[model samples]
Target chain A: MGNDVSFFSNVLYMASNVQMIIAVLLGALGGVFVGFLPAFGSPTAVALLLPLTFLMPTDVSMVMLAGIYFGANFGGAIPAILVNTPGTPPAFITAIDGYPLAVKGKAKEALFVSNFSSFVGCILGAVMFYFLANVVGKAALAFGPAETFALMVLGLACVAGLSKGSIWRSIIALAFGVAITTIGIDPLTTVPRYTFGKIGLYSGIPFVPAMIGLFGISEAILLLQKGKMFEGDKVEEEKALNTKANGPTLLERAKMLPTNIISSIVGFVVGSIPGAGATVAGMMSWNLARQRSKTPEKFGKGAIEGVAASESANNAASAGALVPMLSLGIPGSSTTAVMLAALMMHDILPGPLLIVEQPGLISYLTASYIIGGLAAFIVFQLSIPLFEKLMYIAKPIIAGLVFVLAVSGTYFLRNSLTDIYIVALFGIIGYLMKHFDFPVAPTVLGLVLGGGLESNLRLALKIGGVGELFTPIASFCLLLALIMLVLPTIRSRRTRNEESQVM
Target chain B: MNRIVGLLIVIVSLAYTIGALKWSLWTEGNPGPGLFPVIIGIIALIAGVMCIVEGVIPVNGKQTLIQGLKWSAFLVALTVLVVFLMEFLGIAIGSGLAFAAVLTAGGYRRKFLLILIPIITTVSIYLVFGWWLHLPYVWIQ
Candidate 1:
């Protein structure tokens, strides 16, 4: 506790530096700018700027990047509330109630709740990050190969749970991703596996190219297919929704404090679990709030409580994501995984030893989140009218700008043509998957978890004296996977039977 | 399309499993190269079977196999085309062309998009990566 205070004081002192302040401000501003734009999220932003971080001190660079992350999270809600477009995956749920509110001529109120909830959620998450750092960090370090493998298995099973459509298709995508991961050298042995004698395959499929192809290019294709940049009806409605501001009064806002607190707590707990991110947090919190609301039916129609619940949950989830990243060195989402990559680039491994070795860094990071969150709140509050104007921009221009950014970002990663090709390929895949109603998130998760699962499984086998392959933990994970695979089918069958009976 | 995709995946999984089976499962010390892949391949094959069965059964309002084919074909063509272009033009040029073509084909308008997007993208790549960060343009090499 004493160490924490000293660390906090030291961070506050460091943050007072002019250079650090400027970096934070720039990062916060940049985060909001990128987050406001569709198809550009924090991960891409961080990846684009990662190389530049080499020029700054590691602590300052991390602080700035962290600021960008929090800023993006805050900025994502603006488009979601006013335009019905989620700037990030987590903001999708925000759009559910937020858009309705916008249509109901309460756009400002919805935006206010979103901004406030995000601020509250971020502070709550930072508090959790500060308190749990020592305990969670240690547990993360103690995980062996077997435990890590089991965790990956659990993550894959969670992906199965999150898959919205045909579970079989999701499993197939997961399998394909795993197969792609195996295309490189075997972890236990130096011998190559599925490289097909290609030198590039020896190192496995590079993640950046695959990610760019899947999300960025695929999204571009889909946007084109939709035939217009923005939906005409949505644009008309938004124009009408942009009426005079009649936001909540200070007392009215104060009355919702308890709800924000509860939602933040719920969001943090959900976010701490791997593969469970802001989307789930938002959905869960919104549902919980609805169930507890006096008028549940008002949720989808334009409920301030619904907006608050979703925003709080999503923001908290963003913070909660850091828990696993900091403690277990496991990323809770794609964005966090990218942050992990950035940390690795800096040679700063996050685990049990992180806090002990660099106590000040954790405090610094925590302080950055607080500062970033505050900065985001201030920026959003001041720039609501300006951001609202962005809705009028033509879709082609926005898409064009996004395309340029994605292209440049991919090129900067490795300058490899293969990477660009991979991005295009994935982009097409992402587009088609959307058309077919297959969830794209699981595919990303599968890709991210694939190498970890493979390497750890091999390592655990090597460590367990060969015959111990079927240890209790391994069996437990396999059993869990089996149950996850089977249970969904059974549940669907049961639901169908019940419906038939009712009919 | 659903049945074809399912079948294709199954075949791929089978092929991979066969290859994995041929490798030593274990040596004196290290785990064998095939150990994890073979298991994954087998599970994938099972999943493929489930997908094929589901495709044939037509539970709920799922798209018909033929409907799936159109999308699958378009995407596969796009991917192959992009890969081909990448070999000749390099990442930036290839990506810009691919992006413009794909977007336009998808129904995007504004002729200026093709010109403006590519140029801006290329220049940005040069400034941030080549000039600012000092990362080598490997594709150029």
Candidate 2:
């Protein structure tokens, strides 16, 4: 109870911190700006912004990142509503009802519905996060080295197996990631492993530069190849945002409060599971809302509730996905995985002890979500026209800009040309992997978790030999990993067999 | 293409596995640094072989051209040259050159965008990273 009071006081303290508040607000605005562009998701935004946070205080940087993380959810729905272009995969569901409304000249009502629902979803998710994260943290305190190893395995397996690509390709990506982790000095031993006698490789490939390269530069290359960014007609903003249109009023949109609540709950649950990210959460919640709606026929045809359902759920899931990262040091989504990597870079270890060690972080993060959501709502509300204009910038120009940023940002990491070279290498590797339909998230997660996985395995072995892996918690986690890995193959086989039977 | 990528992966993993063997697989009855790499290598090798097998199966779509490869290669080479000439050329000029080249290659024939946007972006980078974050890069002196 005393701890509760202290936590709230810290939250109040963070709310008062001018720098942190400004950081959060700036991050929110930046997130919204990035979300306006297609194919630039939260992971890319966070990765690009990471180099800037190197000099900041850990709490401030984290809050800023948290702000961006949630703010993007709000921003993502705008493009979906206006242009039928989902800025992020999760927002694809939003486009179903949103774009139809735009076509029907009710884009204003749809935008309001999306904005309000996203804000409410963020609040609900933050509330749930405040309670559930602590519970998960307490439970995770029981995890030993063996359990940790098993958990990391589960993390790797979940990413590789659950990816949209073939499991073999995903595993190949994972293996490649793990291989990258093996470069430089071995964590367990003092011996050099894959450095190839380079003097600068003593610390291994820097995570920030490599990430910047993989996500930033590779994406730029792809954008270059694509030529154009937006294909739908120019988002006739005046027509879209006409205030006097015979569209649903504020009160009518408010009627979606119940749908928002139920969908947020669904989203929160789905997001708490690793590898089932906001895209899945948004889809699940939107479908459930459709099933339960009184006016089911209105779905996918400009139902304001549909927009509310997807936007709310995906936003909530963004918050929910932080539970595992904060509590167990295992990221619940790819964005949080990048966040986790950034946290580790600052030497701020996350896990069961993190909450106890820095109880203020949760409060600050919670406050960030509230403020960031409100800020995003306000920004989107007033500046819809501004974002519309931003969408007009050519993709090639954006690609060029990203290219320069990627080069310079990477150079700023260690102020070394070698880091730049490493980034270029990884950029090519990332591009190739993308070309081959291999998932990249697993590789990032694998690299981030690789050292921990190795160190934990060594520690667990020293403590209890090979038999330690069969301990209840360890075995349970391993079983979960195995199940995740095998389920996809089985499901695909079944799908193939059913298709053949149909033929 | 898939077969070549798979074969490359196989060779790399095989070499990696061999390289890992140079280190002690175990020390004091515990798994050593090499053991994990060996395991990872084997997994990669298996996945590579699987990839090779999967490649044999026919697919529907025609293989697409590696469009924009020339531009992509030019961008990479320009970036390398920029880095190499950082002391002489500085960030702003190098970035502008790279940006203009890419924009031109991407079919932006508009002289205004090709010229103006690069300057704007270069300045923005300077203001954001150089001024705000104080990134100690060699800029136009």
Candidate 3:
């Protein structure tokens, strides 16, 4: 009863706060705009706008950042539908059906279904996030240092599935990320490990500048190679789906609801797993929906259900991606990793204790997410034609804007030019990694989690000797991590074998 | 290139482990700093070995390396230019040159855009970071 009263009181406080409302409104607006631009996915978008949050209170900052993340997920579908170019990986699937629908003069139907699906997905994701994060957080109260160490190991093990090239190389990348984070003065001992006596290396590396480099500057490098991204858009003249009453009424589309529900659940589940982001969730949900559809032939050919499936799953996945980050201090996606960085910067550490330590902040964040989603729906659904003009904006212009944001955001952190240099160095590293089909996400995750991982391991080891490694909970968690790493490779091999046999 | 990367990883990991050897492994019941590094270094070594083996036995076609080298080079040069600007000149020149250099690298050759946009970008950064956030980024000082 006391908890309920406090929770409602917090809600009432947030509801009356004008600044919080404004922050959400501004974040949603910025999210839609930045998300529509080229090479600015959710991570880059968050990293770019992160500086704005630096000046605001932590609650307001989180509200704005949450708004940006949610709005970006919805905004990416606009470009996917309009220009066959997805602003982010998750939206790429939306293009398969959405662009075709647009070409068939039913763009409005595709867009509407997509937004509706996204709304449903966001609602479902929020529900899952609230319940699951709370449950996970509570369960984690039973965890000791050994269990926490195992959890970090499990988090690192998930990097294998995220690798675009060789899993081995990704492991190397993860190790390298951990190694770099272990630089500067040791937390246990005052002795420096890899600082090599440079006073500049005192703080090791700032996650913000590293984030700007990995996501922001690397994006600029990728954009530099592609010439004229918007030039290929085949714009067509079509009437609005709203004006055309002959088409499926909102009620008729409501009949096609099973796929959307399934996709949302799938998305939420996939997104809850560390390292399995929205893109995979969208793709898997889309394929599953198609497999179950009566008119499988209609897929990839302007099917409204396809739009419903992918959009629902992707948006839910985006929301669900927050679960691991908030509950276990393990970021489920790149955007969440950056969000974790933002939280840490503001002296708010998210983990099992977050529920008890900062329940009011959590309540505000959860409310902001819902409010942000609604804002995205109203913004994107009501103003499709307005955002269509964004498709005509030149790629170079977007590149220029992002470039400015990158340098400014990096430099202003602690007012150090050294941050900019760090951005440059990591930018080059990110470029090479992307160029060679290596994954950058794992490294960032490793770096962010490395400090906690190190301390936890040391604590567990100190309390108990080498025997501590064999604790029941720790061993169980390690086995789960091993299974998570091995299962995907085994499945892939089996699929390959089946394909070869069929051939 | 893949072989070289794998070799580099192995070398780096080995060197790291060797350097960690100087630190005390364990003190009484407390685990020293070296223990964690040594364990991580071993994992790194295994990963490196795996990468090297994967590089040695390849079945698929190789993708081209040095993708769009010229553009990447120009972008790097532009970043360096900003570093020089910040050191020699001030924030105005640094940010303006950086923005201008980025535009040029992105194939923005329009005279007005090249000249005007950078100034706008620099000014916006100045007003926001310096004025609004109240950071100490002096434009001319």
Candidate 4:
């Protein structure tokens, strides 16, 4: 009670500052705009905008950047929902169900649900961060290399659930992705293992460009492959769009509030863990919602609950990622890592002492989530119709836009043409993978976690050999991974046996 | 086709695992760069063999690989060509050409749209990413 009162008091105090308010609004608006652009994720936007903040005061800049961080979560969902192209990797989960809704002419409902859930997620995650930041930060700091490695393994093992095809294919895809990550100079010994004498290979295949190719370019190719078949579906969708709005009512949307809150909590916890990003949070929450739902078959087939679960979790995870960064000087994701650098650039050190020394800054940052969420929501709501029109655009134009943006976004990453080649290569690979029914999500998750997994494994071995895996948290993660991998197979076998017996 | 893909995966994983052996598996009594890759390679190798076996097993119905390959190959060729052209024509012009080519390939028959939208898109992209944001590195020079 005392803490709540103090937190509310501080929030009220910061809310009164007009400059702070303006900064949050402006940053959030910019964030939404960039995020709405295909292929421009939050990390790129924040990295690009960081230079502009050098002229501003530390508190103002921090709040503004934080606002952008919060808002990008909302903006990334637009492309994912309207089209099947995810602006960020995590938004891919939103596209699973959200795009189907758009195809069903329920784009308005999809966007509304996404935006509303994001708003709820932000507020709830902020409240949780305020209450548990210190505790969560301390727990996160306790993670050693073994625990981190084990957690990553657990994350990778979720491929069992993520895969909708042959398990062997998913495993191969994941291993292939991990192999690709090993191309760079080894973190442990600085030895280039698979560079093949190319300068770009020394740094390994960049993940973002690879993502752009996998999702964006590959989608374009798939759409083009359909030709007349795709046009037929598009015509039906266009007709559906013109006919009537067939979606869940406002009350039905309201019924998902509990789901939003639950997913937000899940996202917040996952996000607080160092290096466990919004993608993992979104994946985990979507899987959990499927497990808990009465109509599990509706998942990935236009379930509104799927969109609600994923959007809320990803947004809340963005907010929750701040807990470790603000409290313990550890960043949980790439965007927060950049924000940490921004703080250090301003000579504002973040750690245990940060809360005591910079109460106003911390309070203002937490309060900005609500403001930023509201700003992003209003902007998105106002533009829902415009965003939905993207669905009606000619297929050729959409394909061209995806190609240009994918290529351009990859180029902007490091101003390297090598990345463009990487995108092209992955574009072909992704197309083949999709055609073969191999799940791409596992490959993505593996790529994202591969470097960390290796570094942590080597570090843990040095620290304690195999004994490191015996630690409580590490063992718990291994157990969880085992359960995640085994349970589905067992269930499927049981169902098959029962069917055979009935027949 | 599944058998071929599986065989390719097997060959690649074998090569990768062998390549990993060139690097030390352990250094200074700790695991080295080769360890992780070797583990991954082994997993992939096993999975590939299983995929191959599965592919060889006869199922209830005939499995057919669709004819989606030609269009995808065309798109891929265009992508490579556009990137190559960007070196000489600049990103704006290269992208304009790409837009026109892709639109035509995707069966857009309207002549005005094929001509006009590409120019508009090129100029708009340049203005936003090149002039205003100072992003998208190379423009003309």
The best candidate in terms of TM-score: 4
Which segments of candidate 3 are over 4 A away from where they belong?
A1-24, A30-137, A226-369, A380-395, A466-473, A495-503, B56-73, B87-93
Evaluate model 1: give its TM-score: 0.72
lDDT of 3 by residue, A423-473 (tens): 877877777776666666667667766877888888888888668867898
lDDT of 2 at A419: 75
> With candidate 2 superimposed using the best TM-score fit, by how many Å does residue A262's alpha carbon deviate from the native?
10
- Residue-level lDDT of model 2, residues A1-503, one tens digit each, is 11334446655766788997888777878877767544456676676677767768876777777767776778878767765556666776787789788767676677778888988898898888887888754554566788878867875675533344368877887888778888889876789988889878878887656765665567677766656422343235334444345446667866889999998887876676655567656766775676588875577678788898898898888888787788788786768888889878978787878888777667666766676677777777777656444445676777776677667755754578887777777777776666666766567666766777787888898898999987998899799778868876776678779989999
The Cα local distance difference test for each model comes to 0.69, 0.73, 0.71, 0.79
**TM-scores for every candidate against the unseen true structure:** 0.72, 0.71, 0.69, 0.91
lDDT by residue for model 3 (B1-141), tens:
677777877999999998887788888879887887888899899988987876732322232234445555666677777766765665655777777766775667789978988788777767755666565543655
Candidate 1 stretches greater than 4 Å from native? A1-21, A34-44, A47-65, A72-121, A228-364, A380-399, A465-491, B56-131, B134-141
What interface RMSD does every candidate have? 4.8, 2.8, 3.3, 3.3
Interface RMSD of 4: 3.3
Per prediction, the TM-score for chain B is: 0.57, 0.81, 0.78, 0.78
Clashing pairs in 3: none
Judged by whole-model lDDT over C-alpha atoms, candidate 3 comes out at 0.71
Q: Give the winner by lDDT.
A: 4
lDDT of 4 at A189: 91
- The sequence of per-residue lDDT tens digits that candidate 4 reaches over residues A223-263 is 77665455676777678765457456778978898889889
Model 2, position A389: C-alpha lDDT score: 49
The residue-by-residue lDDT of candidate 1 on A400-425, one tens digit each, is 44455555455555656566556656
Candidate 2, after superposition: displacement of residue A4 in Å? 7.8
